[model samples]
Target chain A: MEVMIMKRAIGVLDSGVGGLTVVKELMRQLPKEEIIYIGDTERCPYGPRPHDEIEAYTWELIEFLLSKNVKMIVIACNTATAVVLKEARKRLNIPVIGVIDPGARAAVKGTRNKHIGVIGTKMTIESNSYETALRHVAGEIDVYSLACPPFVPLVEAGELDGERVRAIVAETIRPLQSSEMDTLILGCTHYPLLAPVIQDVVGPDVHLISSGDETALEVAAILDFKELENDLDTVPAHQFYATGDVVIFDRLATEWLGQPVRAEKVEVSGVDA
Target chain B: MEVMIMKRAIGVLDSGVGGLTVVKELMRQLPKEEIIYIGDTERCPYGPRPHDEIEAYTWELIEFLLSKNVKMIVIACNTATAVVLKEARKRLNIPVIGVIDPGARAAVKGTRNKHIGVIGTKMTIESNSYETALRHVAGEIDVYSLACPPFVPLVEAGELDGERVRAIVAETIRPLQSSEMDTLILGCTHYPLLAPVIQDVVGPDVHLISSGDETALEVAAILDFKELENDLDTVPAHQFYATGDVVIFDRLATEWLGQPVRAEKVEVSGVDA
Candidate 1:
């Protein structure tokens, strides 16, 4: 077989620290690949914002990453991915990926009764992104969507596993338990950290799907198929950029990304299409 | 001693059917109080919406009841109360009660240590409404806030006492466990039904505050102060109204509110000053 060569980095962007979760999975699964991550913490929660703004903000981030010569891009924010993925895919020449399809596929495989519950950002739930994806995969499957807008802030605040968080989660996710869903998709990447709590709330019968893990697998598959798998000899270069607090991002990156990561602050001046 | 005039009706309103929990407490505590409840079920969550919108919606519900000649109004939705209580207090002719103060007061009194964990909807937490209320009652207390946006939807979906709801509860509220909070505030009225799950998740050390219970005490206090207390009656009149699914509102009201209440569907016009 001829030797395959890839020169560019893989771009991953999220509304905030949540995308770091997907980066962690990518690091574990695609060790040789150089990764560049941008967390838009400053204008986070693309969830409640207007669709046009979400689309514009997402493209601006993508363009920023593209300027760095990224070979592929990952839209990690559920809200962003829900509304902008199609436009982004068309606008970019390089491979574009989002967390929704992989998560839905995984849920389809994981579910015993074809009943699935999806919880995510307001935009994600409002758009029925996961429901559409799941239905596209298995037309007969039932999809229940609940918008868990507060989870992002709770995680951002660094209260991953606390009583206050638990009470909020228990109260927030209580409605999902009423459904007969055998699987729950952690529609937001930030949600995996909350997997244990979600698992507890959904019960043993319901399987929990991590969008990060599933999306990572999808990345691996795409790279393998395209023959673009990186085989760098030296230490892998991983750069993290945030439009918010670099200090907290550094702490969270170290916690989520496993390796020591120094995240630099990026100032996004204006919205670009 | 002067003879006191009993109030004709006690009005309770929530963004959705979750406020039935407060009505449940009210029914148990004040059996003779005629309850007129309105659940903005069509817009079940006032948490994630804009403050202005929440204020407008609350006033609309309050206005609807005012037209019905309600004596006292209970703002059962944490989000609405957080954003609009002050405005409601100023605008309404009758006594306007919010669940936050009562709930915060209950948390302060119940806690052994001053450390407290508060959980509510996004608006409730983001507004720092509960924290403010708690601090006002007890000064220099360490308060932790987490917004569980999915909670009300979860409870409404019927996952009250189960392993699934329990797991989600544990995960979401995990942060407060380490804070060594002696008391936890269920800042949203809907949160009371998840009390067992919340208690199990938080373990035995933390005492959980039910907004319903606190509001019940407040109702009693207000009634007593206003000299509107009524004698125990064999038959109580409890009327419920919903802007959305009357069937669902009635079902949850019967389950959570303790008494079988026939709720009517009403048009939710804008709230006038």
Candidate 2:
């Protein structure tokens, strides 16, 4: 029972495996803390989904995580975050965090040219959440945003490397080449996995801000501030859950996490209560 | 009267103008927010002071800031923060931010080599706060710490340029020369003003993490997270206060802050009922 009390994991919700980047960072930054991740991979890519449906799915993920008695809630998916984060923050009792704000703050601080480029899914870009977060930090900041529709699908499919993928990435992000942005924000969590290719296209001059790394740091800050850190020094057996095929989820989870992981298949239909 | 509610400035307290680095970053990051800075310049170097005395002076600064009804409190001084931040965060009603944790988290995340260097006042280095913070973030990390007593006094005297200061900085930080720390946390907020010189000494390969920039980013994160941001769009009339000579404080403030300003003298004897 004492061990159970110390085992309440940080609940992480994402549309799919893209949030692995955040998980990777969270593990690296706060190694002692346990994480329970819920990936709504059945309805993967919440970007094109309607706002109402997105919110419902997000709540389902939140509810599942909460049932396990999570200490905090992290909206690791940009599309889900853009849709449900504000409402979830108000509605939930636990401290709620989103990927957008951290990335925004980082881009604002890291940019030398005062001009930033952001690439995300259609919903994330259309929401203009990054622009809002960036402008909220510094008024004089210039933001250039693009929605890379093919990017997420490519990541989810594990088409992350090779000349074909590089060509696709180049053509997809070709519009922002002339924007003269010194800093580029990997607004979508999935983008980091494709970073080597993206860096190849964008060149070394443009700094890439990973939302996962930034958000993980923010989580550490909030945990410390709130005095909600799990004090157990013992390593935790981290858990991963998926709403779709368990085999693929496990494979990718193991690959991205750089460790062996077994993903449990979960049904995220409607709310339990 | 409506404007009065929104005009509550972020109260920033430093031993002296060393924290002006934090204030400068805060203003740049959160431009719309009002700021009220109090520099305890009379007892400028809080490094050599006793713990009990430092705590008392910190409380005095907090009381003065509270009297003005500050929206947030930032302990921008390294020595004071090393001594008083934990207690202040627990005692204060509003959010209280410190310079150390932000730098710690940034260093942990920024370091690829896992070997980091930290430089600060004697008191801050003695506290081993950075080691505690760095170890807290990730285990099996190497940390090299040094106390450069002259850096603060040099910064206070505005010896920010030329070969003399550079030689002093190089000689002072000479102990950590071959440590091979890829990331260096300018653990003292005063250190950033001497960055060019420090960068020359440490070499460009060593990434210097300024507490001010990282702390400013944390302040923004906390403000947005806690819903403590000031919403007014119009410019705010920022105020400056000094416990000692207003002339030197005003001059240094203007030089470091890049704006002309006047500093008012204030007495912080004891707590007000």
Candidate 3:
């Protein structure tokens, strides 16, 4: 008799429900691959935390996924990716991808007027990762970045479409309207859910680049190149983990993924320095 | 002291100047990496040919690029990709990507109502590659395919805009007007150059997916994953080869790429069984 082993799953980590946007994309792009996602909702919004603390929490999430025998790691949160991507890539033997470079590359290619705008959390904007990556590809392009701290909170509260959310989005984007930017990068994973309002404000001329969609394309290509793709004929089940209330996490995942999702609450300990 | 050698260039092949669309994308996404493109203009319009003949001619182009030591291959022509992508991937050691999957994946994701349409050459539409690829991702989505043979000639003749091009586009796309497809795939590389007129005919509600842009994203990801990316500080030079008139090829390349191009005419013999 011959024995068969289950294929390893792709691991994804984020501070909260924001990374679900990326998960939705992965499911669409690579339907056969199994996924294991962790949301650190117990300490949600790693955006406002100190760099060292955010790094420690991200590592803890990585360790948990490693225990689950994940074949790859995707840092879907902008704050975590900007802070710990280099260190994670160095320490992990498997492939590690961050959302920043893919998004940056798309924005650079999508822009025609050499002017690009980026909107993200305070940590991501302050880090200036997008500017560095974009300038690295094209030396003379202009980059404009703004910090929208309230946008993430609005998304987590499930205020995606309404007058209040639209007003907030318009007010936050009012400053960039006259900047004459031909491309805009939604730096945070949570931002895609709010894309319609953002698109309405920016008008149709300015292209909106979503980090999740770009990242998913990168993931599919990497898997094919590395030969790590799941080729089994069996349909794989996806697993979701949260460090806080399972009910809330399940509700958000179900709504965003357009399917019934059950998330389990797991306590993750901090990693040592 | 250790001396570093230059990295191999990315190889791109097309039946004619149509593949410049893909080259334009690669330059934007991977600016540091060198590229070597081959356009078999002496045997242009492979759409109406038999599958076996198209495969043989495509291999001859591949052999020429292999002699140049390319790190990867991109089948930029829709008819060739539909017939030879699998065998090419099997025979080549490096990664091989086709335009069909990327365009199909984008169309699947871009559609909100689960209805999509594909436009390509007669051979490509008859191959049913897009329908198979799209259904592999989503089981119940609707796919409509149409063959527009006259579109390519208009592009090669530099009739990209004006009332004449718009009228031709409207007439060619009239068959799919009642299909209720929310997303349309420009399955052929030449179609993107005519996007303005196509968009005008399709109206504002329908989204257009460009295979060149999507394939470039996949190429960048694979290069990063395989660690085959050129990290040198030297400026990369691109090389162009044609099997037909160098003057005509040079004119089209320079006009489309917005840069001065010098094409070398080379004779490529068909492969024998």
Interface RMSD of 3: 2.7
Candidate models: Cα lDDT each: 0.77, 0.89, 0.87
Ranked by lDDT, the better of candidates 1 and 3 is 3
Angstrom error at residue A36, model 3:
2.0
Q: Global CA lDDT of candidate 3, please? A: 0.87
How would you encode candidate 3's per-residue C-alpha lDDT over A10-78 as one tens digit per residue? 999999889999999998777777899999998987877888899889999999999998989999998
User: Best candidate, DockQ-wise?
Assistant: 2
Q: Is candidate 1 or candidate 3 better by DockQ?
A: 3
Second chain TM-score for model 2: 0.95
Question: What are the runs in model 1 whose C-alpha is more than 4 Å off?
Answer: A1-5, A270-273, B1-273
Question: What is candidate 2's lDDT per residue for A166-260, written digit by digit as tens?
Answer: 99999989999989899999999999999999999999999999999999999999988887877777887788999999999999989889999
Ranking under lDDT, best-scoring first? 2, 3, 1
TM-score of the second chain, cand. 1 = 0.93
TM-score of chain A of 3: 0.95
- Highest TM-score model number: 2
